[model samples]
Target: TFHSFSLILSVGDIGYYDDAGQFYIVERMKDSFKCMGRQVLPTDIEAVLLSHADVAEAAVAGVPHDQYNEVAKAFVVLKPASQNKAIRATENDLQDFVAGI
Candidate 1:
């Protein structure tokens, strides 16, 4: 009917802490990418994608690149009406977006 201190701390250390050490709930952890040796936040990308009328859901990931080391790859789920929407956006588009951040 008892538990060690290590077990208690381990069970409670599941969240994000900022520089100030304030804890916050993490909705998702896989939604992160590293580009040009920097952490590219996905919430920004998701915000932009959501702004577009066609995009329903978007998931982004870092894909290996021969030159850049890693590049952002967006897996978008489009609305039914936009199913036929072409993949007009290119890797350059994502690069530009990340750069602007």
Candidate 2:
């Protein structure tokens, strides 16, 4: 009888090696959610939110949506310096920013 041996390690993450033998950890399974039938990685949205000049911090989560089943909602913390700016950012402003991307 011939048998193959496989070993597994509990690293608490999922990753893959690219064609170039580069290892990349896409996202932690627990931190990912479904949005409109697509897998949405929180870090992806967080990265976009953090790209904004006024955004100091951002946390994204999946929220219930009647039509889409789930949608991304962002909680943004603005920079202290931006608070004193003459022009304040509005919801539409943030929406437009993300839409542009």
Candidate 3:
């Protein structure tokens, strides 16, 4: 048995192509928002936020802004390891952590 290539249909999927000409699916159209004229995907930021050692759980949303129309606002849950620890994650620390990347 074999399969044949046919028509392609888009169902709110978002992706990009690299220099190698390979396509990569990154997110869904519904999951993305406009920020500073650029598409911002909450999942992308959530992935970055979850990379932090102190982030036990993370969720990001687009919040209204004066200049940018919208911006990412993350609601994060700190890991138990951060409780009473010297290296606890703070708002500024988390912001800086993402910014540094």
Candidate 1's C-alpha runs over 4 A off are 1-31, 82-101
Evaluate model 3: give its lDDT.
0.74
lDDT of 1 by residue, 3-80 (tens): 122211222222455655554433443555577788776677777776666567775556677776667666676666
**Candidate 1, 70: how far from true, in Å?**
1.2
Deviation (Å) of 2 in candidate 2: 52
Go through the candidates in order and give each one's C-alpha lDDT: 0.56, 0.68, 0.74
Q: Which candidate wins on lDDT?
A: 3
TM-score of 3: 0.66
- Top-scoring candidate (TM-score): 3
Q: How well is each residue in 6-101 modelled by candidate 3, as lDDT tens digits?
A: 222143444566656554444444777789999988888989899998899886767778899788888788987644677778999999998887
- Model 2 clash pairs are none
- Which scores better on lDDT, 2 or 3? 3
- List the candidates' TM-scores in order: 0.48, 0.63, 0.66
lDDT of 2 by residue, 1-101 (tens): 11232222133345566656554444444676677788988788889878988888776666677788767777687877653686756778888888788
